[model samples]
Target chain A: MKPTFRASMAWLHTWSGLVIGWLLLAITLAGTLSVFRPEISSWMRPELHGRLTDADTATQAAIGWLTAHAAHAPAWYLEAPSPRTPFTYAVWEDGTSYAQHALDPKTGAPDVLRDTLGGEFFFRFHFELQLPYPWGRLIAAVAALALVLILLTGIVAHKRIFLDFFTFRPGKGQRSWLDAHNLLGVVALPFHLMIAFTGAITLANMIMPWGLTTLYKQDFSALTHDFSPATIEREASGKPGSLTAFGPLLADVRHHFAPNGLARITVTNPSDSNAVITFNAIPSVSGVGVENHTLSYDGITGKLLAEHRETRPVMGFYRFLYGLHVAYFAPYVTRWLYFLSGLSLAALICTGLQLWTSKRCHRQQGLGFKLVERLNIGMMMGTPTAFAGYFIANRVLPPFLANRAQMEVRAVFCIWAAILLFAMVRRPNAAWRETLAISSLTCLIISLIGGIPHSPIEWAVSLVSLGIAVLMRYAMRYTPYRKKQS
Target chain B: MLLPLSFIGLLAVCLLAAATPRQASELFTPPLPHKQQILIRAFGFLLLAASFFVGSLSHNAGRLLIAHIGLLGLYAAIISLGCTLCLHNKKRRDPAKRRNNHT
Candidate 1:
């Protein structure tokens, strides 16, 4: 009458995974795409393709533009072009007003590129789900916690995890699905655990804010300030002043922070006498923690003020966890590994969902069974189709259309919604095959529309899209039209 | 460095898989003997350690470890697929074997 430990774990694993599986898949896939955020951003802006400029020249040009356009702004931010990104990202804020522009690295002019979120859409959607602040992050955090639980329960329930580490029996229906699930889960167990745990930790402040509430007591800014204390906080003198030359300051930063180029530049009160300029070092591959090594200079005099490096142990640990999750410091090969591991996690969830439905295939179908079957088909195929739609929208939309970026994102959701509705209306097997066929076609169209790649990143993206098309076509052929009743 | 590590990791995982009786049967006519299985597994573990050692020579040990784990998963999956293909081909080539398996 009582369930054994393994049975309880199995029950928990099945229900928990089924409940949050779709959300986890979306988050994982988005995060995976975010691994190449800069590259994707570059690909989306074909106008900037193959453009290269020295960081100092880009910085000076961006500053010159800002000086002309946003002289009255209190602060200006500049992200210099890097090997992966070919454009300077510049932003200016003046209390109530804010603006951003992608500057041509060579000319410092506003690049006449279609306004799109580019890879940032995927990066933000990973945790935010494109929802309003806090809520989406909260939901993502809860899903991550659920994933950790599901993975742990799965490990407990899978008594043959080690034995089946290298076992996969394809085309055996439920058994094959279960085998694939177990194989993927067991092999990538460490990565799954790390990603889930780190994901939760990344948003732990929101989910578990008791400490913040007790200490800061609604003064969130104070908490943030304490975490990263400003090296120089100077009030604007309001007296007009010209900024000192950036070349020598940049040279000094390079000389001091050798082997690490400047990643970001912040100018506070740029046109005021008390202005401060700070340059942040690009993260190096030598450390697991993101070292916020910065050099500050008096903006008016261009004299070096202070140098700061992250030295606090607690902050170092937190940065380490965050760094692992973001993989900002990852090398080329390591980034590919992260991407593959992310795919494996997504595949593991897919296999688990399919196994749930296939296990009860022979039983009398109930409403719950039907819903799960339809949803599984919709989400597994529909999400990727939606992603492809987003890419297609980027190329197809009018370059200067109003709200073009929002329209592209809307296209993703609309396509996904339509496919979900279609899945519900069509037979389960037919839904799977049709969605797969549609996904394949969309991918093929993307590859063709993308045309010849101008950069290595573009080439990789094009080839990958084409590869997915081929794979989807192959899968479409194999997906059975009718279920074989035992 | 990473390429060599990947090669060694793949070989290591294949050996471990071959030591498993079920997978071994798919790859070999007769499953490997118990003693040989143990030896193969030991060698596999040794190579796996070597891969980790080589990987740790990189600037960051933590990142290297993460990469190593990812590579392990990839290698295991490759071996699993390889074994599955081997079994499928054997069953197709030997009709009697396929008939016996069906029965």
Candidate 2:
């Protein structure tokens, strides 16, 4: 007999989710961590802590350093220090390659700190999967699409979604797992849908480039110019020229925008007579949009050249989708909500994976079933343990060690692999408990020796790590291994 | 202001949960009457709308809307867990009451 509509949906939901569930969890968890990327980066670079400088001073100092070190570069990019991040980040092309430095806000010198990717690693890994360009993003985009499909199918299959909104019965094994899964999925349904859909939209250009190919015809520069018409492109005149003082120009821009609205500054042909400086505004918080308002000035004369604001509806909508995905404009309360909702989505996926295994636990299991069972335990607990290992490695490794950043990332994968192998060798119940204990212990160790937090963001991160350790400890004790063993 | 708005959202979600017949039975000794349940559900929805209206008065209505939805979900989860614990406790006590009567 053919399956009913709901049954077919249930089948699709189960298979689609199971196929990419582990990858999706990793992506979601990393994305959640990325929500606090700036904070994490600041915490990792202890040398930059407690030293605050105004944006104007930092920008000038960074420019001075770049002028001395990279004068031959055609252009330079500068990110002013903000409350969240205390370092002035500068990037410039040096001959054939790009060089980046985190400058001390007070002195404009390259920060004397351990080299590490810090939170940027998680941000990149969330969408890029630590793979080379295009492939990781493509894979993540496909996984996001699959997640949307799974969510829709799960909604269709669960007929009592609304009726059982407030229902949960724990300690009943499989039934309990199903209830928890449904509860997590249904409670944050809108957020899950919004995040998945916006995530795909953010990478839509790469995922669906047929339109670009047909319209732009391989001229990427034309596409960029069309997308951002405010961008000024002028070749260097070759005649040596000096830049005008940045103080007056910055003050002028601040008068037009908010005091902190100027987020990035781009200097093109900084040593040429045709030099131009552009200031990009912060993402808009007043509405559901990203207004890429820009002001351009003649670098030599410091005279305003052009001012542009995003007004086209289609482009505005696109920017809004991108803005929503990144949440660049979120305030403190909203940011916390985004973080919690993200974790709830991860929890939803984890519970769904557990439900899949629990439903089949009593059956005559095949190799596939056994493999999935072990994998479910390994990936769910092992991934977080690996993340904690990354933090631990950051503190334990020698400060000036060569390839220190790579070593920290390697520690994550090494720990994850070890946990996966250990899970494969142990009983499922024991594997779960041992992995939880290890994860908890790693977090506890971080809290003990991660150094006293020098700022509010660092303090929050430290406290959160301690909180996770406590929760993991509770989970380790609460796991029903003892009853099953008896 | 956001704190009070979130509290209102939490109260609204609790009312809506209590209006559900199954949850009402678990939460109350005798389930609320059908007419009262309807009133409570309507009031719950009205409160949600009122909270949204008040929250949108801020300069950034979009941000408030997103945060409001997230907070509502959190409140619902908390209420669901609380109800589950309450029901478990009641179930545990009912058997003791029956045993005492038999004795």
Judge the docking of candidate 2 as incorrect, acceptable, medium or high. medium
Candidate 2 residue pairs in backbone clash: none
**Tens digit of lDDT per residue, candidate 2, span A1-486?**
327999999999999999999999999999999988888887787776555678788788888877777777989998767667667777889878776667777777774756788888899999999999999999999998998899999999999976788899988888888899999999889889999999988888778989999999999889977877767888998898889998888889888777437778899998888999988887764765665788889989998888888888888888888888888878887788889888889899999998888888777889998899899888999989999898889889987788788899999999989999998889888888889999999988888775776568767877888999999999887675235634
Clashing pairs in 1: none
What DockQ, on C-alphas, does every prediction get? Answer: 0.67, 0.76
Model 2 shows how many backbone clashes? 0
Best by TM-score: 2
Query: Model 2 misses residue A219 by how many Å?
Result: 1.3
TM-score: model 2 vs. ground truth:
0.95
Candidate 2 error regions (>4 Å): A94-97, A451-454, A480-486
The DockQ for candidate 1, computed on C-alphas, is: 0.67
- Candidate 2 chain A weakest ten by summed lDDT: A477-486
lDDT of each: 0.85, 0.85
